[model samples]
Target: MNIMKRFLKYTALTVMILIIWVAAIFISMDKGWWHTPFTQDKMPNEFIASVQEELQNEFVGTMAIALFKGGKLAEESFYSNDKPADRNTVFQVASLSKFVSAIGVMKLVEDGKLNLDAPVSRYLTRWRLPHSDFDNTKVTVRRLLSHTAGLTDGLGYAGFKNPKDVQSLEASLNKAIDADPGSDGRILIGVEPGSEWRYSGGGFTVLQLMVEEVSGQSFDSYMQSEIFEPLQMHSSFYQWDENFQDRLCDFYETDGSKAAQRYYTAQAASALYTSLADLEKLFHLFDEDNVNQKPVSPEFQKLMWQVEAETLGTPIYGLGTFLYTELENGGFVIGHDGKNNPPINTAFRYNPVAKDGIIMLTTGSTNFATRIASDWVFLQTGKVDALLFTMQQGKMIQIMAIGSFFILILVASIAFVRRTGK
Candidate 1:
């Protein structure tokens, strides 16, 4: 008699608890206590799996990827766990910093503190390139940002020791250009600016100089204050500052084996550390319509992607960013790629048209081999998740709705019975 009574009482209590849960859910959902969602209605699955396989086969290092569509996070993937490359892992973003740095300079332009057409020599009291009778005359902040300054690419990973190489910017700028005067006529005219586009790391370095001179802040400090902090890019940094060492993953070669060094990393050209999550915030700026409101005006961010030049009748590059159009679908995208060292290869690309983008971060032993891996990540983005995210999202919503609905009814019935009878 005692055991039967105990069992009945416990079962009643359990049922009552479940009924309350369901009632609360139904009430909350119906009363607008819960947010109504606009269903995504689409997902792509086959493409996602293929992308993962491609990444495993091609890129030999740890990797993470995320895709956003219509201004919402659509998909994310991680390939390894020892280093555990995730949205929060920061990779040295290399020349991508040029795009970021340029945004700061352009913001200054918008504020009327700097003129794009003004000769950079006007601001530099610390050092000035000897005005070549021809070459240096055309150099201006605008040309430099657009890589039209005619300055040749100088150091790759070969030039710097680490981010702390304390050499004055002037010393680095004085390195000789390999191109002869007038070798490229448009860039050679010592007349005025806005001539032609040439890929110049030296040009970006010049912009860094300009930012320092005008802001009255060190390059790293200025970027932190103006760009990274504002964007909440907590994982991004310019130099290998001591504080960031722990967050920094060891870079690798292509073999997925041993580590690589800082010199092999793209320092000025490619020396930036950032996580995938932060990179998404940076790329989402390209969206004219944004879910996050603090971003710069879409018009201005779009200006970053605008083609700044055409060479040999084809667009070579845009302002501080690479320009590429997909041939199969004619989709247009703009972004950048880098590996701090070849072993730790990284690439980031975003389609402004599709409002879709991806980033791959890897660390390993061989630089060249890592690039082969990097290419696979890029290919995976357009190939895989592009098609699979839709199916997965739809399935998720259906499961949640059915589960929620059942719980709502059971809880509501219990609540009504308790109020009426007890």
Candidate 2:
């Protein structure tokens, strides 16, 4: 009886301690205890210096950063590993391509070539979504844009080394070489559409096909003519062109070794080569004041940023973009980030209301751009966003350690009680 009492007391004490420790972590994170302080009075030069210092400390190689204030370029900087890199140096922005593709889809909607609420199957003739238990009619363009089409294929394209090996858009959609060979491998509805949010690169591939079918042109060609030409993003391309060979930034592994450039058949989902200079033009697409010949109508642009899905009551994603956080005044900090194997990371974020934003692209660093962008958000808003939590490696390690220790203590206490009672 004495032994049982002792064991129970100790177990109770351990539980209380663990609870306090976890609570402390949540408190510190909520309060932005790990964030760097910034003030409005800080000069642009000072802010730039701080960012440069971070890049050096993180050991990033070949980076380009641009700052936007009041919807205009406030500052820009470039760093190189060995060869010269500048604003014109093109980089393969992985999933960021989806955001651009969303814009293309919206453009078609505005031009009466497509409809957002219409079933995606209505727009495609070349390929259809694979059969699934869920009602296919619910898989609309709007749902696809928001990743609520019930697609279970969480595909991250492992781009091909040889351009010739790239599958046709229809073939790639049928069976992505990199995807798992199970039910989750193919693009099929796993849940009722609009019931939940699931990231699906395959969903965007369907949009690519729809664009081709509706526009009567190839995906790359349609994007070039309708989106890139209007935006004057001359350096942007969905397909490789020999003209860009000399200007493309060489891909690098995290260890500073050169990585071969990869090709992707999923052009709308994973293949967009763009430069910082061109990205600046793309940034203007969000400027409400620049109303001359907009790619998407103002009404549609407003719809694009509106929350389309939530995770546990927190608005996570809008149509084709991420809603990082909402400001007190109801405006949202919106943008997209992209990552690819062989170590490339890119982040672009702006608060549409604050009219301030940051764009960072890096090679030879894993998620370095996103980490820096999270810091920038804290500096601007005095609050941490959701993305920061995803990147908190140190905090995660600490929590995992505490969890393991708690489990061990519970197991030992159970054994002690059982042995004592026996």
Off by over 4 Å in 2: 1-24, 35-43, 179-185, 400-422
Weakest ten-residue segment in model 2 by summed lDDT: 35-44
Q: Would you estimate the TM-scores of all the predictions?
A: 0.67, 0.88
> CA lDDT of 222 in candidate 2?
93
Cα RMSD for candidate 1? 22.6
Model 2, 1-422: lDDT tens digits are 98778778767777777777676776677568865543333344566777777666655668898988888789898888876789999999888899888999999888888888999999878898888898898999999999999988888887888998988888888988855234344676889899999989999999999999999999999999988998889999999998999988878887778888989988998899999998888888888888646777778777888999987577878889988878888868988898887678899898888788988888888888888787788778777776886667477568757775876677677767877788
Best of the candidates, lDDT: 2
Candidate 1 off by > 4 Å: 1-45, 133-135, 159-166, 176-195, 260-268, 291-295, 326-331, 365-422
Tens digit of per-residue lDDT, candidate 1, span 309-375: 6654545466676654332454336666553445555556676655655555656522322232223
Query: lDDT at 94 for candidate 1?
Result: 58
lDDT of every predicted structure (CA atoms): 0.57, 0.83
Per-residue lDDT of 326 in model 1: 33
